[model samples]
Target: MRSPAAANPAPHLHLAELNSFPPPRSCLPFLVRRAETALRRRAHCHSSSRRSTQNQLHSLQIPGRISHGNPPPPPTRRVILLLLLVVVLGAMGNSIYKFLCGVCSDLSDAAFQPHGAHASVAALGRDILEFQRTKQVPEGLSRHVVSSPAAQANWYKKLQVAWKKARPAPTTPEEAGRLVVLTLKNHQKADVDGLLAFYGLPHPNEAGSAPPPAAGHHAPPAQHSAPAHKPQGVKFELHTLPVDAKAVADGDTVTVYVDTNDAPSEIKKAAAERTKARAARNYPTADALQKTIAAAGYRMVPNAKGVEVLAKKYRIRLSGIDAPESAMPYGKEATEALLKLVEGKCLTVHVYNTDRYGRSVGDLHVGGVFVQEQMLKKGFAWHYTAYDKRPELAKWQSQAQAARKGLWAASKPQEPWEYRKAKRNGNA
Candidate 1:
């Protein structure tokens, strides 16, 4: 035994003495830890494999099978039951949260909201930021956009730009509102005004009027500026008109219906009788009455909601915007956008006058959104500068053109009006 052992000399002894000596004192702890850690890891891996194999005893032979690289899982039934319980609990919690949210708001909700516009850029920016957040301004800003720091930064940047553009610093509420209205184009008025009211700002009665000076502040020199008047002849307003998809006759046109009670007495009488005639199954009499009603620029038609109502029909041509014809580029898009916006909604129409084509030309508003503003900004229609010379319209068109949006995406987008002219002249 001694002879054999001496002859062998244990090959590992050379590596222990000749190739590697005792480690330096400074690194001894590290070396010890590393070696111990490796051994523990090996032990742990072996134990884990053994434990995993043991756990799968009650599992399916295939679904819970352990492969060379894969370890078996616990019983599928237990896992499924646990997952289902978790799902049910999650659903119940969500339902409760929704119900509570619907009934009333949490007191802590207002903790982050700014109390009012403090007449400073940063303060107003914060106020508007909160307002936009609470009201979901710009219609539907996604969380991805809203959650980023850029949301606050971009809002502040816009406020600064609008503030600088406003020249003299705004002291009162109306001027501030006007600034907001100008800056936040394509926003609904109700949302804008709600923000203003929250900040103790009043709606601007006339965009041209100067606001009253703040409390204890001396009056600034009265700048004499005449009230702006529309060149439109006999401007009138249609209190409300319900429109629909079928009513959208063209990109630049819509057919709006008002209640017969708002119509002329003669037309009202005719509409009333037509209802009775139809109810009594007197088709010929109803047809004759319908004709009489149509002669007064009125007709009975079902509204966007599909309710058959006796209404006064008006052929409405969108003012300040000339959309492409149906055959022209983006024509269908313009009509569809308008219909989607106005259909199933009651509109507030400011009728300037009837156009030469017997279509009532006016500004259409729904839920405080300016119809023409959206149309122009979206590049669905031209500003029709020949007929309407609003600087705002031109600005919107320029922005769209610069951004190459919608119709402007074309290399050489033709004006809808010009396209019509070329068609009339048979040049294209």
Candidate 2:
């Protein structure tokens, strides 16, 4: 048998080759094979020795491979410290990556963060929304605007009721203005008092506690000059009539039929024409004004010009004649003239008994001038036969004809009645 050393000749040869090997001259493969053989043999020997040692350890009951019954002891302090250092380094790297990601994001979108908005902005937004809600109102709503809407609405309603109670009806703008001015002039402690003043209400103090007029300091007249210069049989009162004839009465407010059958057709037509003319002159169209009028709930009636009414409950007959009772060809022009004369201004009306047509016959005055007479003088309207029987009719007519005013401006001046007949016959 060969000696043990000869059997392990491959190992010696491998060592010799490693010690004397030249740097690759195509001999790497041969050297590698020799090294591999030596390594296998060494592995075989180690495995066999380990098996024998394991058998010996098992017989002596000395623990070797780790198991649940016989596990290895924990590392010493030095080894544990080294492992802890590795864990800490890994955590630091993860933290750095997170910080870099955050820094890379856009700063402009910082406010979009979860808690970006300030508390004050939220409060302001809530207040603005509330303010918007407070301003919204239904149509036909008139408020004093001195305070809250509810307060204003309540105050106006109370004043309106008091006015209706004190005065039976409303008439000329001057009369209404006087009522409003008087109320406004009255000093009261409450905002309601101011609102009442806006409606021209006389204060209770004025009626019950005011000092009597001394010497010549008399109260100013709201209408005609203390009845001295006023026409006879003419008066102003609160008139309430409903557009509908039938309704049950509840509380102080009652519904009555508005008698417009006897109203003059021409006056009604003139009112519509006037409305259109106002829109044509002041705006692109009448839609806006019409919306305003409708929103205000103003109504028209027969035999009335520029009459805004709360049915029979309240009817405001314009104090002056801007156009004829019937809408003649120049009705819009006449209406525009009247509006120009009295718009945004106060005027007075001396009302007579309701005419056969259920219209208030009145002498209208503006700034101490008789509006009807001025209209006639300006040749804007003819003295209607059924309504105007003043002695100056013939004289005014002759003057208007001579001046070529109003309808007389026509080349062959046709009378209003003649024009109507001709129009009806399709010959105008």
Candidate 3:
């Protein structure tokens, strides 16, 4: 019994110890404590993980690096991200604002600015007027006359050089006129007849008399001792020498063919025949005539008094009557009235003389209607007594005055010449 039991006692004692150990302190409290300890450990691990994530994000924001150390707290990281987003958005907004501003500026410029052609023409007119007034040519007359600034400068320089080389700089109005004609002729390539018409110079072939019996050639008998001049007060007269009606320059001026034509008796018929013959020789066809008309430099420009034939390179002013300037009252009405009378009518012009400004001073007629007289009778113009001393013109003007016409309607109407002087002196 002792030998077998002793061995068994060892096993029995182990079993008893295993069952004993006072039901280890209330398992509920122990479990709770273990759970709380576990929670604390997990919270510390989460905080470390958060710190690592923030460090990684901060490193990414910093240029190029990965940080092993703890980064700023979560709240700080959130603030940095929000600030970065705001900055990025602000930069984008600023860029967009600048782009929009540029677009708006371009649109505004295009909308308000005039086209090049119109601007250039206006500039040319203004420069010419300035030159006339100051007697000195501006350096940049051709600046806007062309599309390119470089081209404009080149043309302007050339014009200046030509002007300087043309007989030692103009010293007088006549000299200036000569210089202008030369410049227009050489540089502008203008037609000689057109130029003469604009300047009120007599055309070389104006007489249209068969070339004086070409040195020894027998001439046909004279056609009745050159019809005597009808009395002084004749409303209008027709030259027996045939002439062609080429173009209407203004209310009082017109361009005529510098040649004669074969026609029966009537002056108008002769004129028509001459014009037709000239057209046949110069233009030849309808298309050709249209082309010539289109190429002509002198287009009609409406003015307060009458009209101006602004040719390609020159200007022609009407004669016999003076109307108020555009700036004066009733000036526009006077222009409109003239336009109505002669805008589309075929006219016959009698050349008289050239004025200081190189304008043609002429009398215009449409059939039997005298343009200047009509204007005066209607009270649209004043008789230019300085140059024209015709008694009939004075009578017409008196009638207009009696009717208190156009400018006469004003209490004290100012003359165009006086008005021009006042404007020049800055007193208007």
Candidate 4:
């Protein structure tokens, strides 16, 4: 028995379910937010699809469209043109960078150099390059150039001009000499050929670079020493040359006697022959008296065909003796006697200045023998009165004339040059 409004039980069942459910107010906000969020997502998806379709159609319809993954459409002619342009620009940029770097490097180098030293750097570079090229140095060689004293001197001289042009600061000569010497010493000339090759200097070996003779080639026999002459009242004392360490100690006192009027012609001839023999032997003309000097217990430096003492403490020049190539007249004989006296003794060298021929002019005293006077006494040499105005020389010459020593034996003794002229005329 239900009323008409409640005729169906279904209506009541619905009401019962509704009554069992939670309040609609709590679910309303969530349902509305979810519906709004869903609608926005669907609209966005539809719009994106439509726009994506439109973009695809547009891209496809365009001509010559290219992408990366594929062969890339033969690199569009315009693209190739653009690439070429880029390459050119890149090259140009590289070149400009290099030029700037070079300039900056040069300026920095110029700025850092010693005030005046930079003035001639360009020329020095040129010289170094030239030397390297000529010498065929290895590619890995350091760029810095080694200098010798002589070359350094030349460099400083060149710098002087550079300074004037470049307005560089002034420098002292001593400073210049030191700089130059430092450079020169670096180029040590150890061997004869090596030295000549390095400095472009000449030597006898260079003149004859021929091959040696075959085996069993007959070489000339060695020359024998001349027999010794025991002179009257000549008290001979043997000592080592000062140059040799084993020779007598430095500063050892010695006496010398000058009796130029008493030298004999035999000794003079012997001396001249020895000189000629030495010259033929390819020996240093100056070292002709080496054995004698060394025997005297002193080391010798061969200078321009004459000998010079090479001791640290004492510097001695052989007196009255000029080697063959040094000066004319009795130079050979004088050298010979000086040698004979100095052999095997530690004698003292009284050093003097350079003679006219740039020889170390000094008196050699060995075992109490005045070597210079002995040569003069022997009539082998005339007193170099022009250079040395020793009055005793004049007296000795007169005495030599009276004694008729060596060349003094000539009734009319001619000077060496005059004799040479007469001989040349006779030959002519």
C-alpha local distance difference test of each model? 0.60, 0.43, 0.45, 0.39
Tens-digit per-residue lDDT, 339-425, candidate 3 = 554443334445555678675556655423456777898787778888778899999999989998877888898887788799899
lDDT of 2 by residue, 181-300 (tens): 344333223332333222332223233333343343222211121122565566763322212222211111112223343434444454466466665685434445445433443434
Can you write out model 4's per-residue Cα lDDT over 14-77, one digit (the tens) per residue?
Answer: 3223334543666644443443344345446667454433332342222232322555446588
Measured against the true structure, the TM-scores of the candidates, in listed sequence, are 0.47, 0.29, 0.32, 0.25
| Consecutive 10-residue window with the lowest summed lDDT within model 4 | 218-227
Candidate 4 — number of clashing residue pairs? 40
Measured on C-alpha atoms, candidate 2 has an lDDT of 0.43
Best by lDDT: 1
Q: Which regions of candidate 4 deviate over 4 angstroms?
A: 1-335, 417-428
The CA lDDT at 149 in model 1 is 42
Residue 304, model 3: lDDT of 19
TM-score of 3: 0.32
Looking at model 3, the pairs that clash are: 297-311, 297-312, 298-310, 298-311
The model with the greater lDDT, 1 or 2, is 1
Better of 2 and 3 by TM-score: 3
Of the candidates shown, which would achieve the greatest TM-score relative to the real structure?
Answer: 1
Candidate 1 structure quality by residue, lDDT tens digits, 258-292? 76566777877887798899999999999999899
lDDT of 1 at 226: 13
